[model samples]
Target: MTAHEDPDEDIPTGLDAAVTVKVAGVDQQRRHAELVKEIDDAQEAYYGRDKPFITDALYDELMLELQKLEAEYPSLRTPDSPTQRVGAPQEETDFSPLTHPSQMLSLDDVFSIDELKEWMTRTEAALGHTPEWLCEVKIDGLAIDLQYVNGRLQTAATRGDGRVGENITPNARTIKAIPQRLRPDPAQDFLALFEARGEVFVPLKEFAAYNDKLADQGKPQFANPRNAAAGSLRQKDPRVTAQRPLSSICHGLGVADGLAVTRQSDAYAVMKAWGLPISPYNKVVHSLDEVLDFITYYGQHRHDLIHQIDGIVVKVDSFAEQQQLGVTSRAPRWAIAFKYPPEEVNTRLLDIRVKVGRTGRVTPYGVMEPVQVAGSVVSSATLHNAYEVERKGVLIGDMVVLRKAGDVIPEIVGPVVEMRTGAERPFVMPTHCPSCGTKLASEKESDKDIRCPNSKSCPAQLRERLFSLAARSAFDIEALGYQGADAILRAGVLDNEAQLFNLTPEQLVTVPFYTRGATPRELKEPALVPPPGIRDGRVLSANGRRLLENLRTARHQPLWRVLVALSIRHVGPTAARALAARFGSMDAIRAAGVEELADTDGVGLIIAEAVRDWFTVDWHLEILNAWAADGVSMADEKSARPAQTLRGLTVVVTGSLQDFTRDSAKAAITDRGGKAAGSVSRHTDYVVVGENAGSKQARAEQLGVPMLDEAQFRELLEHGPTPASETPASETPAPETPAPETSAPTTRASGAPGTPPETRDRRS
Candidate 1:
């Protein structure tokens, strides 16, 4: 008879109280089976469907409960439990173990900066010097060792606990990136046999597309890129693996026969010569500071990468140095993984507060207990709008999961509903605006967002508008951020976005921003600062003067920027550029009607209606007239270089520079008909790096991509790409490079009489 034969039994002591309650009427052994079933169902939904019914927090809790139950009642434990496995589900397999010539050891992982620094300190002690480190992006995918025998591909095996790995050679051959034969290189050691280690992964951009295909075929989709790659590579049939998108990045070695490489860098060089794929994000640095810089850079730009990386592997660059550092029982001491802050974390939702945007669009976000996510402390996250808040079913006092990917804004994913104590209450959006107390209005019953109609009077709206005007994507104005904009709006020195043109240094100093709602997100500013940041009674601070000059210097901004500054609904930088290019000036765009403007390329019906409505608004007209009266010219200007110089090219701009701000540098690239990308990729044409340049620069260096300093970048702007001896550009393109969506051209009608007839040229 089974231990679960009894219908009723005492509750397990080691299990969570909640779990005990969940299995109240069931027997103890039966409860263990129930827990397993529930956890497996959640995992299937998460991994197989790619659409999870429960949040990760809830899943983790359930998993914990199952583990506890199994631990306390060993008789109830089952071998088929989810906790006992790592790989995806199998159909049929003749899989057998393959012994490696040398152990495919794992690197010890360190989570925090302190721990990573401690590892570095210990490593330095071991070497009696700060050894040069080879930093490689730790791909979030299955590790594999590829064996090359007699200059031909022999076998591929998984990294199973560093000893014997499962042979998956047939499935590996399906990956196009894994070279079938090694390229002959005279410079490389004449090795007849060797094994190179690498990661097999599904690119992030392709992961979504692949998921869509699976969904269309009525098959469950994989949760993440890593899952997709692993599941695909483990298929019983090689043809199935081939049908799935899989890529490889060879990094290091496991075993070699008659090899004479002395340095890790040299080995990588030989690998590259032998036509093996390598990560462009890996580099060698002499100092620990540079290694940290690489980590920091990747942390900020991880989202920009096509493949996912949980952390970076810092390995001793010299084989001799690696030998001196030695290895532990399960891991190598010469290498350590400095993990990036996890993008997702668990925290308590204390409250939800509404944030009024520039257009009077109010969004309620959760006020979370401060938690570290993505290397930064996040106290609040956007719940989108009131409708979204209700849909997610999150409530106050609920333990919730939050996520912040790369440099993206932190967001509340959802609540751990199972952990709820019933004290949690559903949030209700107030009928009136939080900032101005104006009656809220929603255009339609289906509308997810509620807006404040009193756009002219709301302090929050005005402040946000000013901030938007100076935002990097809009105007490229330096030193005019939200804080400075809020200061000006609060002091009444800036009544409209256009008043920026008329502001004086004397008038600017009195700007005061009274903390409106006092949400926890506002950590830097105090409740009431009469003069912006000033604590003491002062009319004009020195810091305030510098801001005033920046505002003054913003007068010469281009027409496209002016259009963006106007903050027309549905009109962003791309739309503004299209409008400006088509009309040649703001006057023409303003004079055109909704019907005529709708005909313009890239100017759809929605944008056309928004622009027409904005022009017709009494307050908007007043602001435009004010700017015109202030002699803020609406003239269209042309760049010195031909617009097609960088046409169809993608560029990455990074770090602080003496000559140009981050925005201006990006603007320079865009104005020349190039795409200013946030991250580095195989398709990137140039990486313009400045002082304190982050991971993109390091990645570019690793990929052998062309890099231009400020001077060289300016030179390129003047005379175009030089020869290899002068400027070296990488020829290699990345796997699964995303082809940008191509919008078909629509011929535009010439707007109202007296408008410029020239067609717009906003390609990207």
Candidate 2:
């Protein structure tokens, strides 16, 4: 009040103007300071703590905003802007620390394929040509540098800050996959000194078994595999670390005898000879198309692998080219990590839903807000069973973490109880079946799942069983998903899934979907297609017509697939394929006794007995006969060959071939009826030799086995080992129209020209 009364006296008019002008400039400086502080905090959380407080999207947004502001107001910017630097300094550790020869940088990640292309374009522009690319699965684990002196392991250290790291040599020695010594090769060996860089990880099975042990002891389970690996490797006691199932895979060198390596492709071979483990999935491709194809295949089949991977890392294969491109402040200009969509995310658990399975198990599932994980949007995730539901403390209305385990099914990892509000409610397990109202009970004392008493008669069980039979790995009737399968069951189109072969579009167009209460719901409405429930009336439309078309398409499915679709316990695609390949026809397989079936290549006693029992069932036999009568493909249709030229002979391959990959060479041998043995023995018929051929060649000479050069190999292939016309087989029929005579073109591993698109996509 005193200042207001004397305002005119207190402020000179010219001073007031100056003070007002300073405010905008001061505010800009203040905002710039705030931005730097926030960015530093985020980097600290991500790099030092390994616990990111913000989503990647949010962090990227802040970085972009900071960059834009700095560009517009250059004077307000400082050298400390996150855009101008790498990660924060590494956290403190108790182990001995050593500085690296060069900074161990992290690769900048691009989440989308288009951004990946943009990174490639930038590299090409810098280097003045398209560089050869080498793609490897970006192993999701801790990075470590291993030093060697004259072929003996010296020290192993974890990548701490890029420049300095903690020594963990004692613990590293326990990993069997990482060699404590190397074999020196004159041409490629680091004769005096070298440093190898690679990843340390826990194999998936080992991690799972360790977690099981923890669960048995009433300890908290690991949230994810990566954490489990890191925690295992950094144990206080080296003996404890030794007990943990840890392994390593060498990627390439950090520094090699002070000489530049020629190519990254050669680096892998060098590491392999150094007694380090190499992943079979590694591939060297000539073009971007091939690289993309490799990534695509792995993306679809990551679950089939024994370990986990988050994405693929693409590098310029040439060491010279990489030097030309050089390094950035944070990452190399020649390499980029193309990250896959994350498999884990947090979403609100809106409610709980129960599902009845084909085996009558009543399982709980979480209905959640839609979230994208592993390339698909997931709206619901399995809670496994009632006991698990309670053990995870997954309350309805609480936020929960979801992950697509092995890129297969979505499942709840656990609940984020800290974020929960009082509005959240507890889940109550149902004592009766949700479908038929029958009482449920656990199958065994050790079992957590509650099973329904109603078995075959329950509509839910019937629908689920039919759906399983028609899964993509089975008959592959894509149009008949869960909703379509359930709808057809409720509509009484057929009593069992085997009757699906009898369906026609005419019958389907006339059959309307029925409500749970037996009320007729017309199938003509477009909105009813792919609906979730009968009461919900989601997808009860003319979808039946579309499904009928899909069902008809399934008739041509392979006999192995049909066998898998039969719902025989213990007999999946792999076992069924073994059966089909051995017997050649479904009829032959059905007539075989359990012992005979068990004799097949991949079939075990359990699977063989299950197959035999399934075929012996009267109802199953009737359904199979009816399906055959309805024109289903009941026999193996793969084009058959009588026998290859080199049948009944054994061959050994020595050294590396110019035109064939290791796998391709083996395949070629097997294709021609020769057993490809890794070593030459007295029984070996021939030894194919290449440059630098060594021990195998010496053994072959000692044993007096015939040797063949590349040109001679082709000459022998054209005429066949003993002329294919003389080959004999009792059952197999020779091709009516044989393929045009051609030289054994360089094996597929050689990246031969004119490879079909599908084959090229395999890259293996």
Per-residue lDDT for 715-742 in model 2, tens only?
Answer: 4445556433222222213112111111
The TM-score values for the models, in the order shown, are 0.56, 0.53
Which ten residues in a row are the worst by lDDT in model 1? 748-757
Off by over 4 Å in 2: 1-99, 146-157, 164-170, 173-195, 212-220, 252-257, 260-285, 293-306, 341-352, 387-407, 412-428, 443-448, 455-459, 462-764
Candidate No. with top TM-score: 1
lDDT of 1 at 585: 79
| Residue 152 of model 1, lDDT score | 61
Q: Which segments of candidate 1 are over 4 A away from where they belong? A: 1-106, 109-135, 142-202, 210-306, 316-325, 341-346, 385-401, 413-432, 436-449, 470-561, 573-585, 594-605, 627-662, 665-764
Give the per-residue Cα lDDT of candidate 2 at 122.
Answer: 87
Q: By TM-score, how accurate is candidate 2?
A: 0.53
Q: Tell me the lDDT of candidate 1.
A: 0.69
Candidate 1: tens digits of C-alpha lDDT, residues 601-670: 5578999999988988897988888877877657676553245456566778866678888767766766
| Cα lDDT, model 1, residue 223 | 47
How much lDDT does each candidate structure score?
A: 0.69, 0.67
Could you tell me the lDDT of residue 405 within candidate 2? 58
Q: What value of lDDT does candidate 2 attain over all alpha carbons?
A: 0.67
